[model samples]
Target: MAPPATQFELAQPPNDAISALAFSPDSPSRLLASSWDKNVYLYDTLRNSEEGAHGTLLRTFEHRAPVLDVCFGRDGNEAFSAGMDWQVRRIDLESGEQTTLSKHAAPVRRVVYSKEHSLLISASWDSTLHVHDPTNPSLGPLAIPLPGKPHAIAASPSKLVVAMTSRLVHIYDLSALSASLSSHPDQQQQQPPQPWQQRESSLKFLTRAVAAMPSDAGYATSSIEGRVAVEWFDASAESQARKYAFKCHRTAQPQTDGGGSTATTDVVYPVNALAFHPVHGSTFASGGGDATVALWDAEAKRRMKVYQKFADSVAALAFSPDGRYLAVGVCPGFETGMEDYSGEGRTKIFVRELGENEALPKGKGK
Candidate 1:
C-alpha cells in the first residue's frame, strides 16, 4: 500500500497539547481544534495555497482555561467548547460573539453537538451530562447524573453514548432525552430517564475513547491497554457474537542480551482517540500514545494502513464530512501533566487528503 500523504500542517500550531479536533458537518473543509493553550482555532482547508503553504486560519476563540473539546453548531457558523474552566461556551464564527451556556463543578471532558436534534451534550468529570438547546436557552440546560466520571462520549444522529469509569457504557435515545429534558426543566428535581441500553464494557482497562460508526451499526471503544472493542447496538445473539476486541498500538522490542536475542519486551501505548469515516461505516482510525495513527477495516478485522509517526502522541483524530480529508492532532498524552515534559514540547495538526482509493475497501480501490 502507498503511504498516506499529508496535505498540509498548521503553520503556527498551538503552544500546548491539543485535546480535540472536529470537522464541520456542513462544511467539510472547515476544521476546529481545541487545545491546552486555552484557545480554539478555526481553519479553512480549502483555502488557495502557494506551494508548501499551510491551511488558512480563519479565527481563534479564547477561553479562560484549557479547552478540552469542541463541536460545530448546526449551521457550521458557530461552535461550542468546554474544558478545565468547568464551563461550556458557544462562539459565533461570524460575529465572534461568545456566550456562556453552563458550568460544572468539575472539569468538562467532552462536548458534542447533534445537528438532527439541534442539541449540545457536554460531559464532565462531575459525573453529569448537560444537554443544551441553542435555539431556546430559556428552557435552560438539563443535567443528567451518571454512575461515575465519564471517560469519553460519542454521538450519532439519534443516539448518544457515554463511557464512564467502572466499565459502564450508557446509550441514550436523543429524541427521548430531549423530550424528557423539556418536560422536566428542573433536572435536579426530576428523575433521570433510563438509558436505552446499558452494557458493561468487555475490556479490563479503563475506557479511553469511543467513536460512533456512521451507519449506527455500533460504536467502537478503546482502552488504555492498547486494545479496541467493537460493540453492536443490536442485542441479539448473532449480533452479540460478532462483537470482538483486538490489540493494537503496541510494539515488541528485542532485548540486547548476548543470549541469541530471544528476549523481548512488549510496550503498550494507550489508544487515545478514534474516528470513523463518514462514508465508510466499517472503516475507522485510531490514534495512541505511540505517536502513530492507524486506519482499520473493522469488518475485516485487520488494519488497512498505518500513517507515519508524528512528533508527539496522537491525541485526537477526525474525518471530514465528505471523507476527503483526515485531520490528526499530535500532542503529549494528558495522563502526564502538560508541564512535566522533559524535552521541548511540539503540538501540531495535520490534514491529509484522501483519494477514493485511500478511503475505499481493498477490493473497491482503483
Candidate 2:
C-alpha cells in the first residue's frame, strides 16, 4: 500500500508576501521563509503532531528592509538572507542573531548555499554576485561582475547558474569560484572571475526563475512568457540537442464584443518559481502566477500532476530534504497595469506530503 496522501496549511504565516521558501537541510520539518515584510520567519513544520498543521512559528528575524530571498547555511542553526537594503545577512536560528555578511550597490535578489563547496553566493539587481566563505569570516566575499542584473540564481553540486536581464545566462564552475575566494581572503578589491560558460537565454522574454538539477547534469529556467527551458552544461552537441522547452501556467478566457461574437483571450502568467526534488532529480515542480503548482518529469518531457489552484499567485516553492514534502508560497502577483500592490491578508503557505511515487519519472514522452 502507498503512504498516506496529505496536504496541510501552516499556522501563523508571514504578514506579507513570501519572497522565498526554503526547507532546512538537517530536517524536513524545519523551514525558513523570507518575506517582503522585512523579516525571516522560522517554523517547525511538525511541532504539533495532532493537528496535521505541519508548522509552528519558532521565531522571526527582522531586517532593515524587505527580505528578498533566503537559504540554509551549512546546518539548521544557520541561515543567510538577501534583502532590499542591499545587504546579505547571516542569521543564527538558535539564538535569533543576525550578522551582515556584505552589501551590494542595489537590492539583493537571491541567496544560495552550496554544501559541497562551502560557499554562499548572493546575486543583486546591481549586476554583481558576491561569494562568501561562511566558515572563514576574516575572509571577505569575492565580488563577480555581470553584464546584466541577475533576477534568479541556483547552485548544483558543481556549478552555479545565474539568470539575468537581457536574456543572458552565465554558468560558473564552483571549483574555480571556491579557489578564487580562498586565494583572495583579505582582498575584496581583487578582479572578478570570468564565467565558465556564457550563453543567451532560450526563452524570448525576461527570465523569471532558475533551478539547478540535483544530479548536476543540467539546469532549468522559466520566463515571464509562461515557458520553461531545460538545458545541460556539458557544452556537447548531443547534450545541447537534448535540451527542450514547454509552456505551462497559461489560461484562455472568452470575451464578448458588441456584435455578440465571442472570442478567446489567451492569458500568459509568469512562471515565478522552479524546484527540483531532492531525491528524484529528474522530476521537478513549477509554480506560477496562475495560482497553481505543477509537477513535471524532465526526462519524459511530461507533466505528472497539477495541484489545485491556490487563493492567489504562487510566488515561491521548495522541496524538503528527503523529498517527502513540497511547500507552496502564495500571494498577490504584480502584473502589468498594477500601480500599487500588497500581499497583506492574502499570503499563505501550504505543505503537501507526497505519496510513494508521486514525483517519480514517467518515461516515454511525445
Candidate 3:
C-alpha cells in the first residue's frame, strides 16, 4: 500500500534550512520548528485539514543566531531553544515573551527537557552539558564537562544519554543526577555529574543523532557514515548480545574498471535525524541526506516502510506525543551553496497523519 499523504504543509516556511522539529508534549496538533534563519516557528497541524489549506503559523520566536534545536515544556505553553549564538532561550507560546536561560562558550547543538525531573539539558559544541531548572532560572545552570564535543542528546524517563564527536557515549541516571543536584545545592559551583556508564561508541563515524526509546528499554544512535546502532542499557551478556549496528541512507554507483568490468562504489549519506514512535517503542523513523524517511522495526531487525523522497535533504523529524502524526523538515543540507538560497530556496515542513497499522508493526503486540 502507498504511504499516507502529507496532512498539511507549513505556510511561508523559513528561508534558510530547518534545523530541528519538535512536537508539543501536551498537544499533538502543536509543533515547533527551528531554522538557520534565526527563528523558531509554531504551527497548528490541524488548522487546515478540513479546509484543505496550509498549516497555520501560530507564532514566530526570534533568536540572535541560527536556532539549532527546540523542545516544548511539559505544559506545552513554553518552548526552549538552543542555537549558534551560544545561548539558550525560553519562549512563552501564548504571550510571545522570551527569556534567556543559559549561555555557552560555543554554539549549542541540542536542548532537551525532562518532565519527570523538571530539568532542561543543553548540549554545546564547547564540550559541556548544562542542566537548568526552568522554574528557577535565577539560580544559574549546572555545567558538566565532557570528553569531546557533543553531537546529540536524548532522554528517557529514567536515563539521559549523550553522544559526543569522539565516538563517546555517556549514559546518566536522571533520577540520580536530579537527586545529587538537589542534595548539594551549596556545591553546585564545584560538583560535576558522575555518569552511570561511559563507553566508546559502536559506530566508527561521527555521531549525528541519538534517540532514547520511549519504553526506557534502550536507545538508538545514528552516524554521519550512514549507520545506525541499537543498544540496550542492560549490561548482561544476553542483553548486550542484542546490541548491533547496520547501514542505511546509502547507494551504490557502478563504474567501469580498467579490465572493462563494472565495479560498484558505495556512497554514504549522513543520517541527520531520528524519532521513535511515542506509543510504539519498537518502531522509529530516520531521515537523512538521502531525502527519504524510513521506518524501522528495531526488535524485528528490519525496515517496515520507506516514505517517498522529498525535494531536498530531510534535516529533522519528530513524532507527535500522541503518535498520530509525523513532522518532517526538508531543506538543502549544508552542502548547498548559501548564495542560491535567496528567492526560491525556502524550506518546508510536512505533517503526515499516521494510520494505526503504520504506527504499530505487525506481530509487535504493542
Q: For model 1, name the residue pairs that clash.
A: none
lDDT of candidate model 1 versus the reference: 0.87
Q: Tens digit of lDDT per residue, candidate 1, span 140-189? A: 78888899999899988788999999999999999988898778556777
What are the TM-scores, per candidate, against the unseen true structure? Answer: 0.94, 0.95, 0.94
Q: Best candidate per lDDT, number?
A: 2
**Clash counts for all predictions:** 0, 1, 0
How do these models rank on lDDT, best leading?
A: 2, 3, 1
**Which lDDT tens digits does candidate 3 get at residues 182-278?**
6546755566878998988999989999999999999999998899999999888999999999999987899998899999998888999999999
Report model 3's TM-score to 2 decimal places: 0.94
User: In the order shown, what is each candidate's alpha-carbon RMSD?
Assistant: 2.4, 2.1, 2.3
Between candidates 1 and 2, name the one with more favorable TM-score: 2
